[model samples]
Target: MSYDTDIFNALRHRLMTNGFEHGQKVRAEHLRLEFGCSASTIREVLFRLSTIGLVEFREQRGFRVPEQSRALIHELTHLRVLLEAEGTAMSIRRGGVAWEARLTAAHHQLSHLEMRLQSARDTAPFVDLWFDAERHFHETLISACGSDALRDTHQQIYCRFRQQLMIEDRAFDFISENIRHHQQILDAAMAGDEALTRQKIHDHLARHLITDAQVEPA
Candidate 1:
């Protein structure tokens, strides 16, 4: 029972990273051998991951990592911009110095890694660490939004968004621009400019939004 989280996280991390090729079948029997659990247990874990859009099931194909969808990516990107913008605005209003400090701390950690990544000839060694730090900064931007429902929903969207980022951008070619965007967002939030903060967040992810994705003003 206690190890259930370990199993779930193990599978979730794999799906998020390069562990499984897009649309590759996930085998319960193979995972069962690795975890020393029943195939049924592995199936249960994969089912949970499916709910988060990291995995999918077909009529008879069992479980597999989802195929990347340009449409789905655009939709998820729009939602992320909306949720993150609104949440950050709320945090700026409600969260005071404490929230700012946490946000600053999170940004510092993320930016440090981004700077290193900016110049590295090989990014593989820093990939996972950079992803974790990046997620932490965006998450902290809304940590003080004070609504569990909003936070929970954003988390689900973010997981899918992160997975998409992994699939589409392995080389980190835009890492320089990303570093700038992250810094600007932090500056806006720190200066208590809600509108600007919202805009910065949107700008950071605007590339992901297809031209057809008509995002409303934040």
Candidate 2:
């Protein structure tokens, strides 16, 4: 990978995982010294991230991570439910055995980590592993749907959704419920029941919706 691409990805991950605080000014100088790159290179990377809604640029203030919003989280949750449910349904119709195998494997890994985390005194050690596993499971849900555009859009939104909740999610208070939700999703998918899979996906993320009435896949 190219140096600039490396820096961009590192910054993207830091932004997504709460490496930098929300609404904090991105210090290009510090990054330049740390990355051993030029100021303009960092600027280019920040601008690229800005296009994806991971970072925001103000005319005089330069770049900063976007602040969290409850309304935004609700909207993101709704979109996630719609896209994930549709994608899983499409996968069920077209994925065959290969997709099922992949989804099962993904869930196994996530489930193992969650089970261990559920009883851990300190969740710090499992956080990164859990993030990767959780993302892998969800991404595998849509991987065989035969729509790159859908996958790309879902990925962008997923990252933003994680970014908004990174601080809140680190507490691990919801891990137990998440375990049940993920198992239900896995079982529904394995059974090749599209409607049930859709419902399970919605249930997994319903808390983030925070609306008066819970939304289901349409």
Candidate 3:
């Protein structure tokens, strides 16, 4: 890959993982230092981000993380629910011992990552680790769903929802509750309890809609 492409991918991944906080602007000079890129390279990356609806660019205003509407959040949440519930159900039906082993391993690694994030001495490091762990945890849950198309769509929805979610201080109150919800879903899936598993999945997405609305600007 070209240097600019590599930088663009890295920046996009960071935004996806950490949720591009509103007003966290990246200037050309800053990008030059951070990615060892020239001004043109930085502009190219910013343009790519804009093309993807991830940010907005304006003269003098620089690049701004776009704010999503409540309606959009609602729509995304429903889509995620549909995708994940079906995927989880399919996995429950088709997944074998290997899937279970993967699930267990993912959970264990996530637990360690969460602990490190919570007790980290530095805030920036905590944020990075938290986002990484969150992604891995969800990826694990849906990994054995057995349909590449389904998994791709599921991940796309997750990345978009998470970008909006990480824009603010979503860590303090709701994260623990979310972890609990995930645990319940995992337990239901592991036990082959399809109904309870689906319910948990629905509830999880419903909660995302509510939380996104609450945190977003009026």
Candidate 4:
């Protein structure tokens, strides 16, 4: 990857993982020194991240991590439910054997990761891996929907909510239940039960929407 792309991805991951505090100032000079790049390159990378809503840019204030709000979380989560439900139903109808195989593989990976996380004495070490697997499993579910626009929109919403999830540190508590939900959704999809699959998706996502603690003053 190019230097700018690498820097962009690293910065994005840090932002999503809460390595930088919410609303933390991200100075171009600071980033330039950290990444060993020119000021222009850092600005370009920050601008790219801003476009994705991971960072915010003010005319005179430069860039900072975007702050989260309960209202914004609810809006994003609601939109995700609508998009994912419709996309999943379309995937169920349009998916071929290859898609099924991919979905099954993704689920298997996620299930195994969840099992490991559950048994481990400390789940903190496995959080990132579990989240990666979880994302893969969900993406696999709708991979065959044949709508780039739908998939892209779903991805953006998913990323935003995932960042919120990481910030709140509540995902660990839901691991077991999350695994069960994914299993149920997979079962419904494999059986070609569109209604059940959509319902499962909605239930699973709705469970993670804004919690009281997330909105409390920071």
Candidate 5:
């Protein structure tokens, strides 16, 4: 990858993983020195990240990590549910044998990873891997929706939601519940039951559409 792309990915990952605090100032000079790149390159990377809602640019304050809020989280969760549920229903109607095969494979991989995570004594490091599988499984479910725009939109919103969820320090119990929910959704989708799939997707996401007061203290 090009240097600029590498810097952009690294910075984006850091922001997603909460390596930088919310609303923390991201000075271009410091990032340039840290990344061993030019100031303009750092600015470019920051601007790209800002476009994705990971960072924000103010009139004179330069860039900073976007602040997290319960309202924002609820909004993102609602939007994700709407897009994913409709996309899943569309995929169910349009998907063929090939899509079914891919969805089944994705579900198998995700289930295996989740089982391993459940048994592991130290699950922290493996959380990211499990999340990868989870993302793959969900994306595969809607891959046959036949709308590039919808898929792209879902991806962006889902990325932001996942980052915000990680910031919330999602509890192990919640993670276990989420795994079960994924299995339920997968089962419904594989059966080509569009109604059940949409319902499952909405029910799964409702857990996240809560206020800060409703979130379990970690």
Candidate 6:
């Protein structure tokens, strides 16, 4: 638990769950107890997070979560949908029987993990499991798309979006609805229904989240 990169990531993950809200200083003493990190190490990690725009560091106020712009989030999500959809189509066309089998297995695994994680009390471990499963399921479906660069880019954007989602003002109802959407996409993909699969994925991604409840006037 001492000052280590893993500890930094753990703290970052926890902060993410709490909305990564800006303007809340992370005092050295508090971080020392929270992550068991030394002041120097904590400062270094804060510097790194600041570089990524994940944290905002003030000269006199220590650190706080960065405030992300809605416009930026929208742009990233749109690019992700375009890249992922194209990759998925390519994967469907180029993927062989083995690829299909892997995708199916990954989807099954994700479904099982998601169900268990939903009911668990200590949700942290389940959150990690769910993240893994979700990534695996998406990767397996698009692994045969023939471009490692494209896949890597898709993955980076996906990870960033997932981080953004962690900070969004989402309701429990949204979570349940998303789970069902995942199931629908999985079903369509498994059946090799290209048109339906694309349509479902588009619908899943295009569900506007611009409700006033989520947006606050600045």
- TM-score for each predicted model, relative to the true structure: 0.93, 0.94, 0.74, 0.91, 0.90, 0.66
lDDT of 5 by residue, 1-218 (tens): 79999998888777777678777899999999898989999999889888878788998789987678877888999999899999989998899888989998998998888788777888888877777787898899889999999998998888788777776765455667777888899899988888999899989888778856676665
Better of 1 and 2 by lDDT: 2
**Residue 40 of model 6: what lDDT?**
82
- lDDT, model 6, position 106: 88
lDDT of 1 by residue, 10-68 (tens): 88887777787777888888889999988777887888888878888776778887778
Q: After superposition, how far is residue 139 of candidate 4 from its true place, in Å?
A: 1.2
For model 5, the run of ten residues with the poorest summed lDDT: 166-175
Go through the candidates in order and give the clash count of each.
Answer: 0, 0, 0, 0, 0, 0
Tell me, by TM-score, which candidate is best. 2
Model 4, 1-218: lDDT tens per residue?
Answer: 79988998798777767688776898999889988889999999889888878788999889987777667778788888898889989998899899899999999999998889878888888878877888888888878999999998888788777676667666668888988899999999999999999999988877657666676857
Colliding pairs, model 4: none
Residue 43 in candidate 2, Cα distance off native in Å = 1.0
The predictions' CA RMSDs to the true structure, in order, are 3.4, 3.3, 4.3, 3.2, 3.1, 4.9
Cα error of candidate 1 at position 167, Å = 2.6
**Candidate 2 per-residue lDDT over residues 1-102, each given as its tens digit:** 888899999998988886988788898888999999899999999999999899999887789888888888988889989999999999999999999999
What TM-score does candidate 4 reach? 0.91
Question: In model 1, which range of ten residues has the least summed lDDT?
Answer: 209-218
Please give the TM-score that candidate 2 achieves against the real structure: 0.94
Q: Per-residue error at 216 for model 2, in Å?
A: 21
Residue by residue across 1-218, what tens digits does model 6's lDDT show? 54567866776666555544544666767777776657887788777766655567788877876556666567667877788778888888888788888887887887787677666666665666676777788777679889999897786576556656665534333556667877888788768777777777777767543545556755
Q: Clashing pairs in model 2?
A: none
RMSD in Å for model 6? 4.9
List model 3 lDDT by residue over 1-218, tens digit each. 68887987787887766635654776768878877768888889888877755667888878877675666677778888888888878888888888878877777776666566556565575667667776776776678888999897787677667766665435635656666776887799889998898899898667556564476758
- Candidate lDDT values, in order: 0.87, 0.90, 0.74, 0.84, 0.84, 0.70
Model 5 residue 167 lDDT score = 67
Alpha-carbon shift of residue 213 in model 6 (angstroms):
14
Candidate closer to the true structure by lDDT (higher is better), 3 or 4? 4
Candidate 1 stretches greater than 4 Å from native: 213-218
